[model samples]
Target: MEKIKRIEPFHLRKDREYEPFLQFILKILKEIDPIFHFENTVVSEDRIDKPYVSLKTIKKIGTTNQGIEIIIEELYEQVAYDIAIERIIVRPYGLNVDLKIEIESTRDTTDQPYLELRLIGDEIVNNYILKLFTQQFQQIPLDNEKLKRELLILNTMIKRRQWYTVETRAKAILDNFPEHPQALLALAIARAAQGDLEKGEFYLSKVLEYQPENCDALYNLGVIYEQRAEYQKAMRLLQKSLVLKPKNHVVLWKLGQVKEAIGEIRDALNAYQEAMKTTPNPESKIFTSTDFRKEAKEAIQRLMK
Candidate 1:
C-alpha cells in the first residue's frame, strides 16, 4: 500500500461553508466509489443517497459548537481515502475564516500499478482536488503562522529528497502568493535537485526578482552556473553573495571552485585560504560528511603545486 498525506489550509466565510465544501469533496470522491464516515454516527452510512446531505443531519459542523470532523474510507478495492476538516478562531468579532483540510490516501497497487489502475495517481488526485477547491471556495491568503508551516513542510520534503512533492507544495504556495520569495526558492531547489537546471535557474531568477539580496538564491544559482561551466557568471554571483556575507565559508569554498575552474589559480588560492580561516556557522543547514575547512585547505595545497 502506498500512502500520501497533506495538510492544506483554505479560506471560507464562516462555519456555514463547511457542509457545502464537504459536499463538493464528496462529489469528487464519488468518482472513486467512496464511503462516508461521520463523527455523528447517526448520519454515517455505507452509501450516501443524496448528493448533498440535509443540514439538519450535519448541524453546526464547523462552528465552535461541533467542529467539522469526518472520515471516509474504502475507496474501491484498491484505494482508501480519508479527509479531516478543521477550523480555528484567529480573528475578531467571532468572524473566523481559517479552515484546514488534512487529506490522506492509501492505494493498493496490483502488478500493473499504472496500466491496470482504476483511479489516477495520488499526486494528481491531490492537485485536482486542491485546484477545484480553490475555484469552489477561496484560496487562502496565508497568515504568518500558516506561511511558516508551509515553509517547514517544504524544508522537511527537501531533507527527505521528495523533490516532486516539494514542487507541488511550492506551487500551491505560489497560487496564493505569486511573488513569494521562499516559495520560489523552494521551487528552485526542487527543480535543481531534480536535475532540471534550466527550470531551476528560472525559479531562482524569480526569487531574485522579489528578493534581490537573497544570499541563498544567489549562492545556489552560482553553484548551478558553476555546474554548467559558466565560470564567469558563477564568479559574479558568488562575489555578490560574498559581499553580502563575507564570512560565509560555504560561499567562499564555492567561489574558490569557480575561480579554480576558470584557471585563476591565485584568486582560487585566496578564496580557499579565506574559506579555511572563516568559522563555520553552527546554524547552517548545509550538512556534509567532510569538513569544509579541511577541504578548502587541501584545495589550497593542490593549487600551490
Candidate 2:
C-alpha cells in the first residue's frame, strides 16, 4: 500500500501578497483532497457612485483563477470598484463553503495599502484525508494512537505559532469526529489567536456544551467576554473557572482586569494579589501563567497606590 504523503503546513507570511496567499490556500486544499473542487460564487464590488454592487453583469465567475482575477481587478480599480470589494464564497451549500475566505480590498495607492482578508468558516479543513483515516480505523478509542499523533501535530503547531495550520488540522479531525473536545478547544484557541473572536467564542461555547466543567473553556470564554466589555458575563464565567482551577494564575489575573474595568477596585486588587501569590502552572494550554503573574504584580502595586 502506498503511504499517503504528508503536506508541509503553511502559515500566512507578513511579506506575501494577498492574492498569492489566497491561491496558496486553494492549492493546499486541492492537494489535501483532489476530489474537492473550488467554484467562484460571489463577487461584490465597490463603485464610485454606488456603495456595494454585486457584479451581476459579468458572468462566468467559474474557476479559482478567474475568481482571483476578479478580486485583483476590483482591488486595482480596473474593473469597477472605487472604494473596496467585500465578500467571497458566500454560497451556502453544494460547493462546500466550509472555508470561506472573504477579501476586503482597498483602492488606495498610498503607503501601507489596506487589504484585509477574513476567514469565515467552521474552523478547519482537509476533510478527505481525515475521511480516509476514519474509514480505515473504525470505532477508534478515545486514546487511539492515530488521534494522539494528530493532536501532537496540533500541539507542535501551537508552540510554533502556526495558528492557521492548527485551525486546519483540528478542523479536519472535527469533520470526522464532531464530539472531540480537544479538537474543539484547539480550534477555538487557533481562531482566537488569528483575531476571529466570534468564531473563537462559538467553538469555546461548543466545548462547554460537551464538558461544562472545562476550566480552560470557562476561563478563555471569560477572557473573550471581558475583551468585548461584557463584565457581568465575564465575571460569571471566570468565577466558575476559578472554582475548577483555583491555581490558574492567568484566570485570576484576567478576573482582576475585568473587575478593574467595571470600577470594582478593591476586588480587582485582591484578585491581582491572589494571582501574584499563586504558583504559575506550566501546563496552561492557552496562556503563559508566568507572564500573567508578572502582570498581576504590576497591577497589585498600581492598585495599592
Candidate 3:
C-alpha cells in the first residue's frame, strides 16, 4: 500500500461557473495520470433532489511504462440547490511520489468562493519535486483533527434526537463500523419512530444476529410482531424474554395482550394479574388490572350460569 502524504479539501462555489471548474479539475487529473479515478461525485441544480447519487466508470488504459491499478469504491454526492459540490478522495497505492496542488478558481464576486488543495505524498523523482516547489510552498494546512471533532459533534447531535437524528448518526457510525450492534439497534428504534416498520424490523434482526439473547431486542421484536398481528411469533418471543426477565411488568402486560388476542382469555387474565402484582405504583396497577379484572369478573359471573 502506498503511503498517503497529503489530503486536500476543496470548496467550490455554486454559481454558474461550477461545471467548468469541475471539468477543468477532471481534465488536469486525467492529464497527470490517465488512470486516476474519482471516489465520490455528484451534480444537482434543483431543490427536490435526492440526497445521494451513484456513478460508475469504465477506464481504458493504453500501454504504459509501468503497470498501474486503480480501484474506486463508493462514489456518491449530496447536492443542494445553490451548492452543487462533491468530494473525491483518491488512494494511489503503487505511486511512490508525494505532491500537493491547490486550485482556487471562481467567477463569483465573493472572496469565499475558492478551491483548496494539499499535495499529500511524493514518490516522484527529485527533479519533479524541484519543479513543483512553488506550488508545494503555497500549500494550505489540513485541519484533519478539527474536521474529526466537527464530525463527532454532528454525530452527537444525531444521537440526541428522536427519529432523524438517530437514523442519521446510526448510519454515519455504521459507515465507519458496519458491525456495531448498538448502532444497528439505534437505527431500528429511529426507523420504528419514523413509521418505517419494515426497515426497523430489518435492523432489529441484524442486531439479533450479533446478540441473539439480548432481552431488549427480543422484547422489541415481539412488540413489532404483535403490531403486525403475528400472534404466534410474538407470543414465543415475549415468553422467551419473560423467562429471562420474569419481573418485567411491561413484558408480562405484552404477553397478556398477545394471549388475549389469541382467545386464551384465562391465560391472558393470569398474565395480566402477574403484571399487576409486579407493577410498582398505583397508576400501573390501574393500567394493568382495570380491563383484565373486568373481563375476568364478567367471565366468572357467566360461569355461575
Candidate 4:
C-alpha cells in the first residue's frame, strides 16, 4: 500500500485524522498475498458515527512468504466455552509492521469495535501501520463465540450477584452486539441485583425494544416492576411470560411476590404454592430461573399457607 505523505486535513493530525492513513492500511489488507488462509473472516461497520471497521477472522498465520520466518507465538485465551483461542499472535508479518495489537482491553467495555495498536518496533513501517490500524476495529462482532462467553458470565457471575464483573462483561458483549437481548438482560440483572433499580429498569426496557415480549425480558421487567411496587404492570408482564413458559417456577414465585405486594393474600399464596410445585433448576435457556424454590417456600411459610 502506498502511503500518502499529505492528507487534506493535515492540520488536524492532533485531532485523530488517522482515518486517512487507514486508507493505505485497508489497501494493504487487500494487496498482501497472505500465505495463511484466513477463515470465518468478516468485516462490518457497526456504528454510523465511528470511522473504523470491525474485522474478525480465524486464520493460522505462522509461516512466511518465501519460507523465511514470521513473528510467531502461541498464546491461548479462552473466549468462551466452545470457542478457545489456541494460537494468538500478530498476522504473519515478515519485514512488515510488528505493532502490538490488543484485541480487548480490561477497562471500559462499552466503548469498543476499535482495535488498539501500540507501536513496539522502531521500524518506519511499524509506526505507519500502528497509526493506520490503531482503533480500526472499534469493536468486533459478538457473533456466537462472544455470546457464549457472555452466557457463561451471566449464569455464573451475574447469578451470583457479582455486579461489577457482570456489568463489565455485559458492556463488552454490547460493545460488539449493541442492544443485544441477552447482554441487555444481563446488564439489567446486574444493575437490579446491585440495587440500582432505575438503571436496571432502563436496561430491561431497552431489551424489550429489541425483542418485545421476550420471555426473559418480560419476566425480568415484571420482576423489576414488582420490586418497585408497580403491581399492575408487573403482573401483566409476568403473566405474559407465564403463558409462554408456564412451568417457570421462578416466574410463578415472582408473580406471588407481586400479588402479595398488593395485599392479595389468597392469590399470592396460590401463586407461591404453584411455584413450589415446579422444578427449581435453571436450564440452558436465556431468561429462565436461578432456583428461587427456597425463596418461594419461605414466602409460602410467611403467608401462613
Q: Give the clashing pairs for model 4.
A: 112-138, 112-139, 113-137, 113-138, 113-139, 114-137, 114-138, 114-139, 115-137
The digit string of per-residue lDDT tens for model 4 on 1-305 reads: 22322111111121112333333333444434333233322222222221122223233222323111112112222232221111111322343343322221112222221223333443665555545553443334568885886678666775566665566677677766786788888888887875778988999899889888688889888878887788999999999998987888888888998899889999999999998899854673543436777888899898893
lDDT tens digits by residue: candidate 1, 106-195: 222111001011222455565565666556554456777887898888877776777655776777678778899888988888878767
Q: Of 2 and 3, which scores higher on TM-score?
A: 2
* Candidate no. 2 TM-score: 0.54
Q: TM per model?
A: 0.54, 0.54, 0.43, 0.54
TM-score of 1: 0.54
Q: Over the stretch 50-83, how does candidate 3's per-residue lDDT look in tens digits?
A: 4455332222122233222221222233432222
lDDT of 1 at 15: 28
Q: Which stretches of candidate 3 lie over 4 Å from their true place?
A: 1-161, 279-305
User: What is the model-wide C-alpha lDDT for candidate 4?
Assistant: 0.58
Candidate 3 lDDT trough over 10 residues, lowest sum? 1-10
Write model 2 residue lDDT over 16-114, tens digit each, in one string: 234443454455446543555656554444334323443322222345433432333333234444323322221112234345433332322222223
Q: Deviation in angstroms for 93 in model 4? A: 29
The alpha-carbon lDDT assigned to residue 45 of candidate 1 equals 22
Clashing residue pairs for model 2: none
Question: For each candidate, how many residue pairs have backbone atoms clashing (under 3 Å)?
Answer: 0, 0, 13, 9
